[model samples]
Target: MQENKKTIYSWALYDWANSAYATTVIAGFFPLFFKSYYSADVAATTSTAHLGFASSISSLVIVLIAPLLGSIADVYSLKKRYLFLFSYLGILMSAMLSLVGAGEWQAALFIYILGNIGFMGSNIFYDGLLQSVSTKKSVDFVSGLGFSLGYLGGGVLFSINVWMFQDFEFFGFEDQATAIKASFISVALWWALFSIPLLLFVKEDKSTHISTTTKLKDGYLRLKKTFSKIRQLRHLSLFLVAYWLYIDGVDTIIRMAVDYGMALGFDSSNLILALLLVQFVGFPATLLFTKISEIMGTKGAIYLAIAIYLFIIMWAATMMEVWEFYMLAIMIALVQGGIQSLSRSYYSRMIPEGYSAEFFGFYNFIGKFAAIFGPLLIALVALVSQNSRVSIASISILFIIGAILLYFVDEKKGEKELKDALT
Candidate 1:
């Protein structure tokens, strides 16, 4: 039991490890730095387009390859190795960001895109390890533990980084630019240092080694098999569809919130503060949300979260005050980690053992694709109505439809259906 406890803590530490990238780089400093420092010569809109394209391209690459990689990892028992490789790639790229020169937006974008790929791609295998680390009874708590840790970990480093950027002189930095670049190196080191515990302690299910060529061939074959099998997995397929829709709303809110705040004319520093609020609030809230899940059941907890998000979206449409934005951020923090962690654990219940990686490949694929539509939906709405509020509120439809579909996703039915279909 103690060994299992150690393994679980080790596994969860990766979330703590990589989340600094999410907070400091993806959500915090990079965009501001890109606009002011890297692409100072270009028009603001032009730099925005470049950053958007880089994000889309990196996401597209992950969407295309996640499933195949999962299949290969499953067949070859390579989840840990793959996780290490991608994490190393991310860590290296993050550190390299410090080396890019001013007015070199192209090089900065290239490195940032690679870093995004590394951070996002490694999650596929890290998620695959979920099943190996915890039993069914403990999965929800365990999953929530990871996200809670992520919030705390990401928030801690980001707070320090923010201080460094805001007061570069205190840190003996030459300037804020130097401070921001130094933060990148800090994220890389934090990611690398925390990742060591997982590599050293956590283990995956063992399988026999085979030639690389044969492994590749078998991987493709396995992926093909999963494709045919997935169609017949009625309830599981239904859950994935529901997850795709609702998570679309969730992810869109997460990715676009700061932009939405700017559109409402709030100060950038206030937006940053709101983000910090989410991180700190999310830490304890996720654990509380997990407890709520235990009482309400996973699906029930998810439904409650969806209901809250729907309300948040509606509130956002009419909210005109910076304080209102902060309130919305707090509300989102309460449910965000809970929903994500629960969805991951809930999906784990329906997939067969030994095939966790490939199935989670599809899981990650669906998740990555979820980010695309809500953004498009917002852009389309904004284009038609010329109102950011209307664009933001339009996301409610995704959650409404997702909740309706989720009503029919019976976990027992999914497992039974998968079993019969496989036989």
Candidate 2:
């Protein structure tokens, strides 16, 4: 299918929209605010455990409902509607965060859980709509475009939020805590405003009208068939396994990087600056990575990214200075978006037509489920050895194993097999 510029741009802009939540709320302020503001009365470790528990609950919810919802959306051709539904839920929850007062840790965690569910759940349908916008030949560029714009958009708002928090009185806020609360509202507005393009311009396949009871029955049957289909599609299965492993390492590093920096005794302000560096650098680097994929092939590009990540892990474990941590952050910025965007595009090429949402659900399922493992591994290693560095080094195993499995995945063969199966 030929790409529609309007549809493609609009579809990509949704990434530009929601990433404000990812950068500012998820990665930047929420953990700090939850720890110092909401959970201020509790012990530091207690707050940490509570935050971790909330994260697990959100991930668990998404893992449980992802494929089932994806299958149902496919049956009803309701990807767009589902996407907006979850996005709004997230948006509403984000706005609500501003209202939780001091010492309201439980309420904060509860709303954060719901916000996370909305953020991650909506992505299932958003990813499903990829085929509606771009063809195989154009998918790489289009995917890269979305991620690049995401970096830029998320960075822009996060920078302003950081400024607002740093110089609260300049922003006309009474104090830093009040400024942080106000930042949540900023993210909600930014997310809502940027999402308008996709709502207005992008389109999905027309929804199939059916009785609710039949829809549920057909959706359940389709979900079962999808499980069988994965078993039959050997290379697709292999890729998912590989994806689950490496992406776990990727996500673990993303979620844990700041914590690691703080563990190493770096100031929080510097760590936040490093994150800003990543956002700005990632924008151009992601586009460059797409060009590299064009030259080296998608798998080769992914392999290169995995190699870089491996090197980063090794360096992170041994590094001493705060500047060294900044260097590692720059390194992560280089390949982070490349690996992610390429993986999505690569997977897009292999799945059967008309089931993108369902397959992407499985894709997300593996990713979300894998999330639970890496953090636990880190915790376990920290408990047994009492070494944060050793725990950080442990993640390299995921990349190594993922790369070995990815070596055996033949994308050409997978596409051929899918076509043959369909025929």
Cα shift from native, residue 180, model 1 (Å):
1.5
Off by over 4 Å in 2: 41-46, 383-386
- Tell me the spans in candidate 1 whose CA falls farther than 4 Å from its real position: 1-3, 40-50, 205-207, 376-387
Write the residue-wise lDDT of candidate 2 on 334-377 in tens digits: 99999999999999999777888988889889888777677666
Write down the worst ten-residue block by lDDT for model 2.
43-52
What do the candidate models score in CA lDDT, each in turn?
0.87, 0.87
Q: How much does each candidate deviate from the true structure in C-alpha RMSD?
A: 2.1, 1.7
Residue 12 miss distance in model 2 (angstroms): 0.6
Query: What is the per-residue lDDT of model 1 for residues 300-412, given as tens digits with 9 covering 90 to 100?
Result: 99999999999999999999899999999999999999999999999998877788889999998888787656666665566567687888898999999999999999999
Winning model by TM-score: 2
| Positional deviation of residue 342's Cα in model 1 after best superposition, in angstroms | 0.4
Candidate 1 lDDT score at position 327: 97
